[model samples]
Target: MAGILILYATIEGHTARVAERIAKGLRDKGYRVDLHRADPAGASLDLAGYEGVIVGASVHYGRHPGHLRALLRKHRAALAARRSAFFSVSLSARHKPAAAQRYVRKFLRRAGWQPQQAQTFAGALPYSKYPAWKRLLMLAFVGLAGGDTDMSRDYEYTDWDGVDRFADAFARPLDAI
Candidate 1:
């Protein structure tokens, strides 16, 4: 069986958890899986050996991490050639679905990445991890969205069932490619 690669770019670690869950789900389904981070430390890696790829990233302040953008640009050809899925993690998806969809569309347009499948997953808010300024900003945003405003704890909105469904859908096309 050809291996699947799960690449992720995360800020506060939720996206990374999502990537790991996807990898584990695929592995449970009998596919070989490789989980890799797209941070600067992982810049040397490529998707040349994988039969299928799944790329995931989190959004912060309406933007994805710069390293993830570079990674996509660098491996665009290889990524486009394979059976691939791209998932975006954003708190906006949890609060406002339309805006999140627009964000994903804009991201894809800017990155020039047209994957076989794309999804938007709700992200988490790690209030404890945020600095004072960011915490205040996020609290305001969350409050405006009618979401949790508690800074003493974190909130996760990821839908695992949706992720499992996505993984299953992505896996179905691997054999054909």
Candidate 2:
């Protein structure tokens, strides 16, 4: 079976965990998977070997990482030729679905690569991982947005079941191939 490639960019680790879950879900369905971090300085990967590809990244300050965008642009043709999907992780996905969708739209527009499937997943607020200033900034932002403001503990908003469903949907087409 041709492998599926799971490429991701994470900040604060939640997106990485999401990627891992997707990889696990695909593997459970008996698909070979190759998981790799999307690095800006790293050498380009050959997307030809994979039967399908799933790209995921988290939003910070309202944008997905620039490196991931550059990577997508660099390999846009190869990505378009294969079965592919893009998933975005953001806090807005939980509270502001339209905003999350906008982010995804803006990202794909800038990258110039539209995949077969796209989704938005809620990310976490890891207060402990942020520095003092960022933590305060995030706290204020969340407060204004009517989200979790408790700094004493972290909060995760990702819907794992939704993620599983996305993986299943993406895999079905590949299974048919």
Candidate 3:
């Protein structure tokens, strides 16, 4: 069976959870899915083994994880030659459409990825999961964006249905490839 590789980089785990859902959705359709977090500093894994590749990452301070960027650059040629998809996760995606779009564009350009399908999904603010400093910083940023700032709980802004649809979009292309 052909394998589908999902590599993600997440902070506070929201993107990780999304990756899991996407993997499950793909697996449900009988694709052999291999889910793993992108290693920033390590030996570059050969992407030749996977028939299709999906790369996901969350934004922090207006940038993606540095190591993932390097990896993407290293494999950009091979990835562009195959069926590939990219997803960016961010809290700004929920409230700041312009910022989210700009970030997505920036990431795509920086990563040298020209995926047939790309998605910018809203991420979450897990106050309970954050440390004191992060909670305050995120709450302030979110509050400015007109979002709930209560630090006692978490807030999720991702649209799972949209995520499912994106995964489905890649499914057929993956199978065809």
Candidate topping TM-score = 2
- Looking at model 1, which ten-residue stretch has the lowest summed lDDT? 39-48
Q: Which pairs clash in the backbone of model 1?
A: none
Once fitted onto the true fold, the runs of candidate 1 whose alpha carbons sit more than 4 angstroms away are 175-177
Per-prediction CA RMSD (Å): 1.7, 1.0, 1.3
Task: Give the per-residue lDDT of model 2 (tens digit) for 58-152.
Answer: 99889999989988998999998999999999999998999999999999999999899999999999999999999999999899999999899
| Model 2 steric clash pairs | none
The positional error of residue 74 in candidate 3, measured at the CA in angstroms, is 0.5
Best by lDDT: 2
Error of 2 at 76 (Å): 0.6
Task: Give the TM-score of each candidate.
Answer: 0.92, 0.96, 0.95
Ranking by TM-score: 2, 3, 1
C-alpha lDDT of all candidate models, in order: 0.86, 0.92, 0.86
